[model samples]
Target: MPAYGLRSHAWPVTHAVTELIAVNAALTPGRELYLSLRHRDSALRIVVWDQHPRHADPDTRALCEARRSTALWLLAAVVDDWGGEWGSGEARPPQQGVKSWVLLPQ
Candidate 1:
């Protein structure tokens, strides 16, 4: 995907990368993931899409977390330190997947 208006800030970049990894891990073996970056509403928005419409079950998520505590911790740290917002939900429109996104102040 094409990227635009991305900044060089370390925390946002780190958060984005970690989020991408999380999305990739959540995808089924043969499925694909999509990414989008944009500047909007005075913030930088980063989104990652995966083929699953619903989030993984708690047990599954916990299993993944156990294997990826560092990256997930870093992602959480950045969002908490920077006061940014992040979430995942059903994708819009005819899309058949989930969109995980982060909005960091510019």
Candidate 2:
């Protein structure tokens, strides 16, 4: 990622990726996870995929709040943009998983 001029964003992006993997590993053992970093145009994108799409129910404010109170918040703070999606049809080949991504200016 640093090779793409992301040296300044690498640490925080790596931390966010690590936390996402750790959280998924701890909460959903035996499931597969994937991490991807891409540099396009003038931006760097970091994405983490885990096989737990419905891990948190956004309909429940309390649960959402609890889930948001983690490294994800810090990730959002450090990146230019960040978001997540629950579905198997995005991020990679068709599969059941959740995709969390952060984008930083290059």
Candidate 3:
């Protein structure tokens, strides 16, 4: 995996990423970061999760077909921070497929 770039509290977003990595690593040994694209370059996919799954946008409610708010903005921020085009996808649990994506520009 690429090294965690910049280390400055001024960049809360970057610092948050580092903290998330550390927490995940501590919580789940060998599973530090949720996404790892060491294999190759390709389009990306992202599936966010939350306990409550409904939304103010009736359209999104229909689109996601979810239960509570899924923090879509936060998801986008993460993807943008990581330099990738963002898109939505359904996540079927109890064997939901993978949870990472690649967004190669056209």
* Candidate number achieving the greatest lDDT relative to the actual structure: 1
Least accurate 10 contiguous residues by lDDT in model 2: 82-91
TM-score of each: 0.65, 0.64, 0.30
The root-mean-square deviation over C-alpha atoms between each candidate and the true structure, in angstroms, is: 4.8, 5.0, 8.8
lDDT by residue for model 2 over 37-102, one digit each (tens)?
777877666666777545354466446335634535555565524332221222455745656666
Predicted candidate 1, C-alpha RMSD: 4.8
Q: Model 1: per-residue lDDT, tens digit, 2-69?
A: 24444455557665767665645555457887778777776777787767634469887655445434
Winner on lDDT between 1 and 3 is 1
Model 1, stretches more than 4 Å misplaced? Answer: 1-11, 53-73
Candidate 2: count of backbone clashes, pairs at least 3 residues apart or interchain:
0
Tens-digit lDDT string for candidate 3 (4-56): 33233224334334433443344335432344322233332222222323356
Cα lDDT computed for each candidate against the true fold: 0.64, 0.59, 0.37
- Candidate 2 TM-score to native: 0.64
For model 1, the run of ten residues with the poorest summed lDDT? 1-10
